[model samples]
Target: MRGCRYQACRHEPLVVVYEDNVVDRNKKRWRRNNEELPVHLRRPEVVRPSRPLSVDQWNQFAWESSQASLVPCENCGRTFAPDRLEVHQRSCKTPLPGAPRKLALQQVN
Candidate 1:
């Protein structure tokens, strides 16, 4: 006769329980509690740097080389390194050639 073979199969039925919902509920409750607290009492947020902490010297060299191209100033037409372009542009008094002229206000007669 081919009946039940496993020994523990007749024991208490096994049940699977998932704790995902419980964890999510707990997180929501914690966040709500923190939000209710005053700013001074709340924990400070962590700050992270945007760039990598330790860049290799070779990688740094490659990055500088890639960005080393000179950019022409729109006002003076003079080329400056990408990093210095902004500083040069700020002090450049020469206006762009053939640029539209500003209209002068006419005085009342």
Candidate 2:
């Protein structure tokens, strides 16, 4: 077989892991929902079930997030959410040297 590229079986059932040190294939993509995981493993970006915040703090977060979403991409000059920026950047085709990437980013940011 030339360059046999068989990926791991995805149909297999996900297994719950307790130990942090041990490498569990299932837990690599997502942490166990029911049980507590390591500090690093927990995704802090998730807003739901997060710590309580003051009205001011919530308002600031909302405004800042909205502003960030409106910021345009340096390469494409099209606005996209911060999370989608990385994906868009990958597919976006950068123009020739004559086209200014820095200027667009500066104006948007």
Could you say which candidate leads in TM-score?
2
Tens digit per residue, CA lDDT, model 1, 39-95: 533433222344655668557655654433335556555655544666886787876
TM-score of 2: 0.31
Give me the candidate number with maximum lDDT. Answer: 2
Root-mean-square deviation per candidate: 21.0, 16.0
Q: What does candidate 1 score on TM? A: 0.26
TM-score of each: 0.26, 0.31
lDDT value for candidate 1?
0.51
lDDT of 1 at 101: 33
Please report how far candidate 1 places residue 86 from its true position, in Å: 0.6
| Model 2 CA deviation exceeding 4 Å by range | 1-65, 100-104
